[model samples]
Target: MVQQWDIVKIIGAIALPQMGGWVNGYLTRQEIKGWYQNLNFPSFRPPNWIFAPVWTSLYAGMGYASYLVWRDGGGFSGIAQGPLFLYGTQLALNWAWTPIFFKRHELKWSFVELAALTATVAATGFAFFNINKLAGYVFIPYFAWCSFATLLNYKIYKLNPESTATIEEVKEPKKKTN
Candidate 1:
């Protein structure tokens, strides 16, 4: 039995991450383009087009998982606040990583943020299990993706130590065209 708030919970879950994705895209549009075109990415990198669909699906899963917990009356109303709070915290951390990495160009700190996010996700999943085991299961893929992303962030950081500089901070020597 889905309540009206259930839909809102689900939407909130997905929308929050979607908002993060939007901010990431909006703020990093040029950086993202230049990354693909210019950076020495790790060999295992996926096509840029792949990120949209993958994140969309993952966000859906996250939202559904959260909806299950929220609908079960496990959020602020029950003993589940700790877990949900962890969930919310991780989501915020997830949101901030983009700006840290792209806008501020803090690859090293971005990786640190990812590490915190990974820990938070795990705590949230474990907390979710206490309330709804199925909800805990839903986060498995999200957890996996974050783990993979941590490694990817590290690789990117290693590949482009110069990326620490914001676009304006680093000056490129101009090439003369014929």
Candidate 2:
């Protein structure tokens, strides 16, 4: 007998962060061609379209693993609290990266955020593994992806140091008083 805390809930937990991320990604995608996608990439860059499915699958894995922890690890009271907190922390960091990199066009700062997100995910994985080996192991792929992303983010930053958006420069000067 599956309870309320089943696959659907797990998927929902996983999807929540992704939902915010996708909105940011989609809203900024139209401007990406001249801004981000065409920037010089490392030789190891994967084709662009691959990111969608890869992220989708990874999100699913994240959801399932978190569910296992929530269900099997005593529902955030005893052993589950630590891992869940770490998971939520990393998830927020994960949610922030897209908007920073894509919408704000802050490559160097985005790399910084990616570095934090990668580290947070690693910490979450350790906490989760301590609670449930499967839960912790599930994050391994996400950690790996984030690790790769750190390098990719750095490469993009190096490749286009001049392309950062200048919000301050875009602001209009105050009009002279009458």
Candidate 3:
């Protein structure tokens, strides 16, 4: 039996991360059929169909984990501040990566950003664990996914040198020597 306030908090918590994903998904959908389809991904890159479900699950889990932290740690004031701050930091980084990679086409920079995101997520997980073990446990898959994403980002960055080239450079023809 859950209280109305608890339900509201859970919904809010879950919505925040999912909203970020929705925005990022918008960016991804815009490019997936065009730019993303043509990009040079690593051999280990997962099938395109797999990403949405995995991400949805991870986001929901982390969001619930956050709610636990907020509830157990006594809201934003007191002990919740540090962990919540960490969660916020990681969420921002997570949101930033999609725009950087999908919209701006900055593969290398996105990888760098993702590496930072991975580290931040790990820190957030530890912080959440300190506050509530369940929160920390829920973060395990999120951390693992971030780690995998970071590696995938690095591999994609390496495989696609042309990703950095400007549109002008791509469209221009090279002259042949006699």
Candidate 4:
């Protein structure tokens, strides 16, 4: 029923977003150089190396799930579309958090954003389960990762309350001192 080209297109669409998200995560790592060493992370926090492999697998699963949903068609109207949209939105939010937290160094803002991201992903997973069981299953790891990330964000925020100040405000003091 489905052509090979259609499958390719679906894979492309899904892969592009996932790739962007992957890149975003990597950029976040670069932006947060020395972050782990500097911060008082929780004992349960996984090592920095673990994030790469886990995220790589999660992104691959996301791409596959998107392909399955694409094969079904109907976009948002399709059974999987609801989850797809939710997934997409959360991914976009996920990408934004890196820039906010790492580049901007707004830990509190990042905390709020991560919370929203966690909630949206959970909702997406729930929606996906109602439509495609496999697709829903694929998102479980992503959801778990987000949950862990949320806790990390919360701890970071609490540990560094003043870290939330805007760049302009935080930088002004340094400029004056110099």
Please state the error at residue 48 of candidate 4 in Å.
Answer: 1.0
RMSD to native, candidate 4: 3.3
lDDT, candidate 3, at 120: 94
Task: Report the C-alpha lDDT of model 2 over 1-178, residue by residue, as the tens digit.
Answer: 7776565787686777678667766866776676666678889989878887878887777877777788777987967888888888888888888878877778889999999999999998998888789888988999999999999989988988765655553365446798
What TM-score fits each model?
0.84, 0.87, 0.92, 0.83
Better of 1 and 3 by lDDT: 3
Candidate 1 C-alpha lDDT tens digits along 84-174: 7887898888888888887777888999999999888888888787788898998888899899889998998899887666656656644
Task: Put down candidate 3 lDDT per residue, 24-133, tens digits, no spaces.
Answer: 98889999999888988888899988999999998999999999999999989979899999999999999999988987788889989999999999999999999999
Off by over 4 Å in 3: 166-178
Native-referenced Cα lDDT, model 2: 0.82
Residue 84, candidate 2: how far off, in angstroms? 0.7
Give residue 46's lDDT in candidate 3 (0 to 100).
95
RMSD, model 1, all Cα superposed?
4.9
With candidate 1 superimposed using the best TM-score fit, by how many Å does residue 44's alpha carbon deviate from the native? Answer: 0.7
5-121 per-residue lDDT for model 4 (tens digits): 877776786676667767777777686566535766666777777877787777777777666665554566766666677778987887788788877878888889999988998
Could you give the C-alpha RMSD of every candidate to the true structure, in order shown?
4.9, 3.9, 2.7, 3.3
Which candidate number has the best lDDT?
A: 3
Candidate 3 global lDDT:
0.91
Quick one: ranking by lDDT, best first? 3, 2, 1, 4
At residue 48, give the lDDT of candidate 2: 79
